[model samples]
Target: MSPRFLCTLIIVLGFVSCGLPAKRREDKTKCPHVKAIRNFDLHELLGSWFVVQYFASSEEALSYGCMRPVFSMSSDRLEVSMNFTYTFTDDPAAELLYGNITWEIPNPSRPSHWVHAEDTYEGVYNTYVLDSDYKSWALLLHCAEKSKSPRYLSSFIMSRQPILAPNVVTYLREKLPRYDIDLAYMFPMTQTNCSNTNRESGLDRDTVRYVIKQSESNRRHPMKRLHKP
Candidate 1:
C-alpha cells in the first residue's frame, strides 16, 4: 500500500477505536472504588515514579518502555501534575514520547483520590490510590466513564525505582481483582536502557501523530494484552 493510504487508514482506525459510538453499549467490565487512602500525605507522594506494571481493560498488549513520571504538587496540594517520558516497546530506536496529566483533588480529606483536571474527556474520570507506602511502592486505579458508554479502566503498579520486590508486587496485585481486573492482564513494563531515554525525543510529523493517536485510541478499544498466559 502507498504511504498515503497507510496514513489514511491509520487515521481512520484511530477514530474507529477511540471515538465514541453513536449508540453506547452497557459496560460489561465491573469496576468499583469509592474511597482512597484517608489522610494521605501529598508531600510524601510527590517525586519521580517508575511505572513497573500496567493493566487496562482495553489494552491487548504492553506498549511502553522506560516509562517514568516526575510528579509535582501545588503549594496547597490541591493540584498534581505528572510529566512523563516513555518509548514504544517495539521501537528499535526507542524514540522517546512525552505527555502530561494533571489532576485535581475534589475532597481535601481524601488527598489520594483525584479527578482529571483537563478536558481530555467530557465526563467523569477518577484516579484513586488504592495503596501506597510513599517511599516504596504504590498501586493506582483509574476509571473513565462517559454517558451510556463502557467504562475504561486501567491500573498502574509504580515504584520509586525501576524494580519492585516480587513479594511486594504480589501484595499489590491482590487488591485488583475486587475491581474486576484480571491478574493475567497485568504486565510488567520494561525499564532496561531507560537511564538514557530521558535525554532525547524526535519523530517525523506523520509518525508522531500516528503514535499519539493510537496511544489515545487504546484508551477505549485496545487490541489485547501483550502477554498471554
Candidate 2:
C-alpha cells in the first residue's frame, strides 16, 4: 500500500476508535424503598400531630424548644403549619423565629406531595409512608431539589407527642435504621404542648367519634367490609 494511503487509513481508524461510546457505569447505590400501604384511613389520620422528634440535616439551624409544626387533614389533602423559635448560644435571649409551611396533597393519583412555606413553586417535596393502624406515627423523607447543594435531603420520625410510649418510641427508633435515617440529632419536642381540641372544632364531634369507632371495629374484624367514601 502507498505510505500516504496507509497514513490516511490510520487516521480514519483512530477517529473511529475515539468516537466509540464509553462503557456505562452501573449505579451501586440502591434507591430508597418508599413503602406504601394499601389502606390509609384519612379520618383517623387527621387531627393535629406534634413534632415528636426529627432528624436534622447539616444545613438546618439548631432550633430552640419553641419550634413546632402542626398537621391537620382537610377533605382531600393535609395542611401543615410550622412555627419555630431560634436562639443563638452566645445571645440566648436574642431569639428570632418565623412560621411558614405549605398544605397540599401529593396529588390525587400520586403517593408523594410538595410542602411549601409561602409559595407553591418553592418548598421541599416529601415522600411519606403511614403505619397501617394510623395510631399516630409517620416517616417523612424530604428533598430540596432547588437548594444550592442539589443533593440536600433530610428525614424525620414524627409523632403525636414529644415523648411517645416507651414501646412505641422504641419501635419507631428501631425502624429508622432500616430507612437509612440518622438518629444522632433527633430533637424531641419536649417543650411543645399538644392540644386535644384541635380536631374537635373542625369536624362534628359526633361524626368524628362515629368514624373512629367504625375504624376500630373494622380493625377488630378483618372479615367485615369497611365502607369507603
Candidate 3:
C-alpha cells in the first residue's frame, strides 16, 4: 500500500478504536469563563489535530513551528500528547519537545468543557471548545491560574487539515470578543516542514525524567500554590 494510504488507514483506525470516557463529576456551568460548544461529543474528538493559529503571551511562547495535538482516551481521562521541534536561534537544527496532559469532563453534561492537569507542568488548564464540526475545525480556549497571584490565558484554532480556511479564520476572529480573548497576541503556526518529521508514539525520555525529577523535588517545596512560572 502507498505511504499516504497507510497513514490514512492508521488515523481511521485510531478514531474507530478510541477509548471510552471514564466516570467523572459533570460540570454544570451554563456560562463558564469561556463559552463551550453545546452537545459536543467527546468520542468524535479522538485523533490528531493540526493547530492553525494560536494566541499566547510572552511567558508561554517557548516553542513554535509545526505543532500537532493528538488525543486519545486513557483508562480514566482523555490523554493529550504532542512532540515538536523548535530552535532558540535561526539554526537549521532544532530540538524536540514533548508535552503531555490529561483532561476530564468535569461536567459530562457539558461535553465541550473540560479540565486539564499536566503531568509535566505546574498548571491546571481549563479548556472549552468554543466550536467544532467534528470534521473540519475546532476553536479551544486554554485558561489557567499561573499562581495564586497571576493567571494565564490563550486560545487555539485546530483543524483536521493543516490549513485553516479564510472564512473560518474570519469567523473565529469575530467570535473572540465573546470569550474575552485578544486577537492581537495571536500567532499563526507553520506546518509545511513538519510533514517530514517522525511522530513519536508518546512523550520522550527527557520529558519523563523531568516530570519525575520535579515531582520528587516538589515534595520539599510546599505545593500550597502551583506556580505557573
Q: How would you encode candidate 1's per-residue C-alpha lDDT over 129-165 as one tens digit per residue?
A: 8888999999888887666656777888999999999
Q: Pick the candidate with the highest TM-score.
A: 1
Q: What pairs collide in candidate 2? A: 102-116, 106-113
Counting only residues 3 or more apart in sequence or on different chains, how many pairs clash (N, Cα, C under 3 Å) in candidate 3? 5
TM-score of 3: 0.63
Candidate 1 all-Cα RMSD = 15.4
User: Tens digit of lDDT per residue, candidate 2, span 1-229?
Assistant: 9866776686677643334464654322322455665655445554445455555444233333433455455454555433333222222222233444454555554334434434443334454543524566765555443444333345555565555666766676776655555666555544433222425336565665565455443222110111111
**Candidate lDDT values, in order:** 0.75, 0.46, 0.59
Ranking by lDDT: 1, 3, 2
Q: Of the pair 2 and 3, which is ahead by lDDT?
A: 3
Stretch of 10 with least lDDT, candidate 1: 220-229
* Superposed model 1: Cα runs more than 4 Å off: 1-31, 195-229
Clash list (residue pairs), candidate 3 = 26-106, 26-107, 26-108, 27-106, 27-107
Residue 98's lDDT within candidate 3 is 48
List ranges where model 2 is wrong by over 4 Å. Answer: 1-33, 59-62, 74-91, 94-98, 109-124, 130-135, 147-150, 192-229
Cα misplacement distance, residue 77 of candidate 3 (Å): 6.2
